[model samples]
Target: AYVITSRCAGFKDGACREVCPCDCIYDAGEQFVINPDDCIDCGACVTACPVEAIFADIDLPAEHSAALHFNRAFFES
Candidate 1:
């Protein structure tokens, strides 16, 4: 799964949603979020984000690790 970090909060560019083959990305209130269960780990969304806000779950920065849980909760709720 790829997580959308704070950098995407105000800049929901949405390019990631457009290229996602699985259609796992969604328009959350402040930023776009990826559905971990639906994501295929294709890495397409990472390149599509103009703000470079997407990162593989394993590669996420320490401070941005919370984004992973946030993304999961988005879909769970």
Candidate 2:
């Protein structure tokens, strides 16, 4: 699954949501989050992000690692 990171918090370009083939992305108040369970891991959202905020869970940047958890929590809650 792809995690939407801090860069998207206020910038919410929403391009990712449009390109997501599986419709796994959602607005989480401040930013968009990808539904880990629904994401197909096809990498479509990554390229559509204007801020480059989307990253695969395994490839998440060190500082953005927490985004992987944040993404899941949004759905869980």
Candidate 3:
């Protein structure tokens, strides 16, 4: 899964959402979140992210690791 980081907070650009083949990205108020289960990890959203906030789970920077949890929380609820 590619998690959306805080750089997207208040931007929520639709580019990522528009290119997501699985339609797994969603507007989460403050930002957009990718649905891990539904995501095929195709990485389409990563390139479409205007703020460069998308990152694969394993590649997620430690400073932005909280986004992984936030992405999961969005779907869990």
Residue range 1-77, candidate 3, lDDT tens digits? 77889889988888999998889999998988888889999998889887899999999999998999999999897
lDDT of 2 by residue, 13-55 (tens): 9989898888889999888899999999999888988789999
Looking at model 3, which ten-residue stretch has the lowest summed lDDT? 1-10
lDDT of 2 at 7: 88
List the candidates' TM-scores in order: 0.96, 0.95, 0.95
- Candidate 2 weakest ten by summed lDDT: 44-53
Determine the C-alpha RMSD for candidate 3 after optimal superposition of all C-alphas: 0.8
- Backbone clash pairs in model 3 (N, Cα, C under 3 Å; residues 3+ apart or in different chains), count: 0
Q: lDDT (CA) for every model shown?
A: 0.90, 0.90, 0.90
Model 1 C-alpha lDDT per residue in residues 13-75, reported as the tens digit of each score: 988999999888988898889999989999998988888999999999998988988999998
Off by over 4 Å in 3: none
Query: What 10-residue stretch in candidate 1 is worst by lDDT?
Result: 1-10
TM-score of 2: 0.95
Q: Each model's RMSD to truth, in Å? A: 0.7, 0.7, 0.8
